[model samples]
Target: MKFRRKKSGYAVIEILLAAAVFVTIGTSIVYLLIDSGYSNLQGRDRVLAANFAQSGLEATRNIRDSGFDKLTIGNHGLALQNGSWAFSGESDIDQSGRFSRQIQISAISADRLLVTSNVNRIAGISRPLNITFSTYLNNWNKTTLLPPSWNTPQIVGIGSTGETTGNRNPFGIFVLGNYAYLVADQPSSTGSEFFIFDISNPQTPTLTGKVLTGKRVYSVFVSGNYAFLTTQAQGSTRPELVVVDISNPATPTIVSRTSFNGNNYAKDIVVVGNYAYITTLNSNSREFIIVNVTDPVHPVTTPVGSLELGSNVNALNINGNYAYLATANDSGEIRIINISNPAVPTLVKTYNNPGLADATEVLFSNDKLFLSTLTNSGTNPNFVILSLNPSDLSIAVIGQTQLAGNINGIALDEAGNQVFTATSLSSQEFVLLDITNQAAPVIKSSLNLIGAAVAINYNGSYAFMAVNDLIQQLFIIGQGQ
Candidate 1:
């Protein structure tokens, strides 16, 4: 104690520095809170505006329910007339005076009317927000066949069913008319893993209904009144194939679920007729499972057989008696399965090349087969076009070209002349490749995105993409974009 060193200024300096750091961190946290508060306020209003637009549409529906003549072609406002909903002025302002709503009606035919509802945030708000909902109304009593298909939006990812931020991300999407069914990649504690949306408009999709299913869903295929989901088994009790009844898009319920014998991840699914073909991640165990879905309510049968592909199958496409699987095998990139016998599926052939290895998506259109693959840094073919002989199912590569990054998904127009792809590139993830001339393909158009585009759907005029971003999970890519 007597030999203790003199007090050093360094200790005091260190204490002062520590105090400064604490102050800085506290100040940063305070600023972040303030900024987030403002952001949430704007976000909450957008949700409200979406609800407002939906209300306007439903009100029109109510009017239609009363009488078809009420849906006259014109821009009309909504009001309560004689205790019944009716069209009024050009636009209606909310009581809060924060939003304005307008309805536009047009005749598609004598029995059908295209109804659009538009909502916008009024003045006084720092940021402007607008929402739109469009749907085709039909005189159901007068129709004999199924209702005509609905309008396809240019860009749609997520929209209003009062959706909130949660531990979820977009994984699968299927569009039916103005409706889009979305499946998330993670389980929601709130039990909303499956979601349905109204995509009659762009950018802002409308949420209609949602339900809970698997702990992790990889892909979704909608056929008839059922939504077939490829989900990962959380445990022995959890299932790999979960089927939900979406007869009423507003309310979906899980009717049946099936689990495989081995531990695996169910990746992609494609429903054809009475069979639901699902692929799993690469392993010794079954990588391809075929379940008889004739009875969607009770889909799985005892001893449901599966095939081992030995390689990872990222995606699958069905054509007639064949199932094309895009795989990541060194010896074979595309595995053609003869599904003529669903219970006993056999591998027909495997296609692979020097530069093309990890195949991600396979698309069949006309007499052509398109493959989107992950590429290397240099010249590695990623977009491949092949000529297929449907009779014999022979494959011959017509041409291929190197792309910047891994191609996540591909969709073709009705004409099959243009090809659309979502890539993993941070920028230019959405690309349009001209395959009009199969011998040579060139990039026609591309839209820069901040994150990777995971999945995509196209209806000639519009491309609905499910991106990897939480804030903008789904969006529209107009033909013009």
Candidate 2:
């Protein structure tokens, strides 16, 4: 009778354990459901935020396309009033309760506008999530398109002194006295590497001599009676500086070849006094090497006197006691070296800016440092002008203008107040800019060449361009008043 009574009901401890387990499982399920809901809401907010941000950008662009005067500096909200896009001082979208958008317009130049759009999501949260987008919008509708006669760029003549071998890759060009030396890449079977053109007749250029260097020549600089060239390495041979005696334009001969310690690939060379400053890329390192070329027959490298730039030095220009080196990297940099004492050069100053991305060429003239850069988003691909203080080597940006393509070379005409740019993009091979007012550079004329313009040099009234098109590889552009 006692056993029957005990089994009729469960123990108190068993009931307590069962209750605890049930409570634990119920709590976990509730928490997980709450977390999942929160995550879904956050994602939804992000999607809305992005959509609203993009909408804001489209509204700004629409306003710009309609009229540049519609956009003004400061914060503004886009709205549709009376079935038309209108900007309001308040930044709240009537349809989007949790979202707010604003746009800011800044004038970069008289014709350029820097437009920025921002969207914020405040869904009853302490911290609001925000998204932003920005771009430069030029007033293309208002842009004045000048005719070719405004800049007066006339084609004087065409010459192909080194195109007989079927390789029309004309790279570096140097005009000295009555002769123009052009360094071109030839097929391995051709043997000839560089060509000399008789330019005494500016209208007609005749190939007078061709020399074989057994290597790919990239640049050539003439000094006195010698032509210094920088060549690309062939096979296991390291690149070297080849000195050619051009005393007679009809027959030029290589007198000496100077090699460096590392596997150097010379990109450019500038001769100052008795030294030859070369911008080279050795292995992965970049530097400017100094070689003593006092005696053209036997050149000697300086004793650890190379200036290491730590970036790819694309172009170099020596002005007075300073050398301006334009290094092209993710963030373009201009390194100024104090070559006051050429033997032991020191880094004097370095300048960098967002507009200087991929600086391909540099020219110092009229107390200004002009730099040409590759095409990059959010940047004007044209050349940037900076004021240079010769006393202390200080630099300040004057302004920037837009060019059509990637500028590879820049030839400054200080006396003529013009800047010639050689570009590599199709349809924008050669460009002429009038720098009469350094603060505001306007495009004078542009020539659309069939080939890519690789290099440009200005002498007197003519600009010699090294082109790599299928038909014409060399062009002489006459700049007329």
- Best candidate, lDDT-wise? 1
Query: Model 2: per-residue lDDT, tens digit, 108-128?
Result: 888878777787875545456
For candidate 1, the per-residue lDDT at 44 reads 72
Tell me the lDDT of candidate 1: 0.78
RMSD of each: 9.8, 19.8
Residue 239 error for model 1, in Å?
Answer: 0.5
What TM-score against the true fold does each predicted structure earn?
Answer: 0.67, 0.66
Judged by TM-score, which candidate is best?
A: 1
Query: In model 1, which regions exceed 4 Å deviation?
Result: 1-166, 202-204, 414-416
Segments in model 2 whose C-alpha atoms lie over 4 Å from true places: 1-150, 165-167, 234-239, 301-304
